[model samples]
Structures are given as structure tokens and as C-alpha cells.
Target: MKTKPNVLPAHNDCPQTTTTGNSRRRKAHRGIEMLSAMGWWSYAIIIVVCVLGMLFGLYIFGRSGSEASNLTQLATATQRAARTQAGFGTANLNTVLYNAGQIPNGWTYSSGTIYNQWNGTVTVTGKTSYFTITDTGIPSSECISIAQTLAAGGVANYLTVGGTKITPASDIATINTACGNANSSVNSTTKTIVMYVGALQ
Candidate 1:
């Protein structure tokens, strides 16, 4: 006398679950694999390019540094020659030649100091004070010598072969190169340097 459950299509109408084989999904997996391979190659190429660029940049920088050092050494040599000035006297001449406007060794001058004076004379005051000058007038520009005769401060005016006169200039590039952007000039015809070194104190 027990009640029985109804087990027929009308009584249980829910749709049964469906299952698909793994073969149907093969296409999606193949596409993913292809994309991964392309990405790996692209990354490798980018890394190589970056390394090569860095090496090239380093090479350029190294060369520039070497050139800069050479220029610096040349500049220092020029300045020292201009600063450590001493007496300029020939074997027979008794008159010592120097920039007239410069400070006399162990003494001082009152003209406020001048670097470029075209006059034939200078004024100095000291215990051992004496005026010094060389005949700077030249008939042609070809009669000049480039030498440094100073202790070590600025660029030395190249003294004439014989300390007979002072020199002046109009153009800069005939006989010598400029010293590290320092103030350098020469006579128009004689290529004489008008610059001179003096005591600064």
C-alpha cells in the first residue's frame, strides 16, 4: 500500500547535461602557442639593440675625454710661460727689458696696471725699480718669436728675438694659437703680441 514516484519524461522535463571531446578545442590552443613564440623573438631583438647602442655611446665619450685632456695640458703650458717673467738682456746690452707698466720685482707701480699700452715707456716704483722696454716697432710681420718667459700666471707675450722693442697686433691667427680663450692679440703687420704679464698685488 506505499506510494511510488513518477519516473517518466513528462514528470522530469529538465534537459540532460552534454559533454564535448577535447579535440573540438584544439584550434584555440594552437593560436595561443603561436602568439607566445612571436613575443619571445621580439623581446630578444630589443635587448640586443639596446646593448649595441650603449657600447657605441661609450666609444664616442672616450675619444672626447682624451682630446679634452690634451687641450688642457697645452693651455697650462701657455699660461705658465706668460707668468714667470724675468729680465731680458742680451750678452752685450746692459738695459734690461720688461713691460714698462708692470710691477717691478719687490716693488709696485701706481698706474692701476695696464696689459696693452702702445707707448714706448713704462712707470714703476720700488727699491730696485728700473724701466725696461724693447724696440717693438717692426718693418714686417715676419720678425717675431713665440716664447714664454714668465713664472706661472698668464700667457706670456712672445718676446722679439732681440729685446729691442715692444710689439702690437691687429689679427690673432698668424703666428700662434690662442691660449685657452685667454686675451691674446698681435701687431697688424709685424704679428707682434701686445699682451704682457705683470705682478697682480
Candidate 2:
């Protein structure tokens, strides 16, 4: 009898998958862990960049504020210096005018000596002559202009500052040159500004 050996199907030799779902779950867990590690690095980098940006902003703001403060201080100092010089100049002019006898009937005196005897009004030729003094001082263009005009009107004038003779200017150029080196009454040791004027009549 030709009995065929009890043969099964040729595809029955493959291994049976019993825990396929468990394998898939393990693979998914590994992928999540990898993503978590990469996320931690990215978060750290972002925090560092933000902190650096804040620090840089603070540095720039501080530097600009300091510069502005310095400039303000410089401007204040310059303004103070200018005021001081101007005040000193005004005092010098008053002192000189007093000595020249222009403030108190200096025109009445025969001698051209400087005097500090300005007290009250005096009469000359039946008319009471009052000393009319202008408040123009150094660094003022009017001061130079007045002096030049007086000289041209036949009024001989002499002026000195701090023991240095102030040579009268003959031209506009000379006036500019002379005023720069001019000193005030405060610079003098005698505390007196000397100026003598006489009518050349």
C-alpha cells in the first residue's frame, strides 16, 4: 500500500508571534526617551541665550547714562566759568570809572590824578553836573567803543589792570587783541583800578 507520509503544509514552519504588541510598545518608549534628551538640551540653550541678552542690554544702558552725566557736568562747569569772568569784568569797569572821576564831577578837577572821593553832586558853570556812569564792562563791545569815542573827543585817557598798562586800541583788530588779555580789578594787588582822564581843551 503506497501510504503518503502524514505531511503538513510547507508554510507551517514559521515561528508564532505571541508578544508583538509588547515589542512595539518597547520601541515607542525608546523613541520617547531619545526625544526627551534632545528637548532638555534645546531648553538649556534657550535659557542661556536669554540670560546673555539681558546682561548685554544692562551694560549698554549703563554706559550711555554715564556718558550723558559727564557731558552735563562739563556744560555746568563752563557756564560757571563764564559767569565768574563776566562778574569780575563788571567790577573792574566800575572801579576804573570811579578813579577816573567820571562818576563825581571828575571834569571839575584840574589835576588828572585818580581819586576815590565820589560822594555827592557838584556844580560847574551854574549847572549841577551829575556823574552818569554806564554799567558796561569788559567782554562788552560797548566798553571798548565808549573808550575809543572818548579818546576821539579830545579826552585824554589812561587805563591799567593788574599793574599792566592797557594800551588803547587804534583799530578794530587791536580792540579784539587787547580785550582778550584784559584783567579785572580782582586781579590787582592794590584792589584799585587806575584810570585818569582829562579834557584836552
Candidate 3:
């Protein structure tokens, strides 16, 4: 009776309260850690997407450059063949040129057919004083870019994008207009480019 002097039963609830508080704090900490992990994952995903986009862009740029180079090589070789070969104006100009080793490196030629970087058909047709180089399956934008560059450089006497003729003297506006016309086709996202380069003297 003397020991029970209103000691309040030793307050067993104090230990329970302390344990509950610690548990809540641990849950909050775990939540914070989970949020932090999610944020990191989001950032990682964004970085990966950006890297993939850049790589795709680079691939497109490199492919365009290669196409341009290939076209240039074909033009140069045609000019040289025109100057040296007596049969330059034949109906089978591509075969004749390829037989003479006029085809550019890396181009696939078999049975008189030439394939471009895009696996498109590349054909060479001849006239008396000029020859035509036609490449098919070009992307619309790349077709525009290549046509503009060749026109600006005065490399081709005349060229056609989607069958719209453009000359070396064609202004940027004119070229853009021609390309726009070709790009308006809903049936196809690709185009054909035909270049007419005069035979070298």
C-alpha cells in the first residue's frame, strides 16, 4: 500500500508512443527515398531518349552526306566517260559506264542496275551532249536538300525534284516551291531526283 502512492502505473504507453513515432519516421524516410529513386529514373529515361534522338539525327545527317557524295562521284565519272568514251550516248549508258569502271565506290551494280545508299535504283541515261542521272527512293527532305545544294553549286545543268525541273539559276524560293509541290503528295514520303549534267568538253 505504501509503494502504490499514485505513481500512474509506471506509464507503459510511453514506450509504445516512442515505437510508433519511430515507425512513422522510418516510413517517411522510406517514402522520401522512393521519391528520390523515381526522380533519378525519370532523369535517366530522359537522358536516354535525348541520346537516341541525337543518334538518329546523326545517322540522317551522315546518310545525306553520303548520298550527296555518291551523286557527285557519279556526275564526275559521267563527265569523264563522256569525254573519253565513244559509246557514251548509247541506250545502255549505265552498263557501258559500269563496264568502264565509272561507277562510284560502294555503289552496288549488277546486271546493269545500280543501287544507291538507300537501296534505291540509280540509272544513267544518255543524250547527245548531256546525260541524266536518276535516283529513286529519296526521302522528301533529302531530295530537297540535295537538289538545292547541287543547284547552288552549279554542278548540275538542270535537275528535277519529283519531276519539277530546277535550273542552276533557280533561286532558293524557286527550289523551295518545287520541293514543296513534291512534298505535298500524300501517297509517298519519298521522291525521285533527276540531274542533268552536261558532258565535259
Root-mean-square deviation (CA) per prediction: 18.4, 22.7, 3.8
Better of 1 and 2 by TM-score: 2
Ranking by TM-score: 3, 2, 1
Candidate 2 lDDT tens digits, 99-171: 4334332222333322222211211110011111111122322234433443343322443322334444556
Whole-model lDDT values for every prediction: 0.34, 0.37, 0.77
Candidate 1 residue lDDT tens string, 79-119: 33222344221121111113322222322223443121222
Name the runs in model 3 displaced over 4 angstroms. 1-17, 85-87, 169-173, 180-187, 199-201
Off by over 4 Å in 1: 1-24, 77-201
Error of 2 at 11 (Å): 15
Clashes of each: 23, 0, 0
Error of 2 at 116 (Å): 52
Q: Choose 1 or 3, whichever is better by lDDT.
A: 3
How many residue-pair clashes does candidate 2 contain? 0
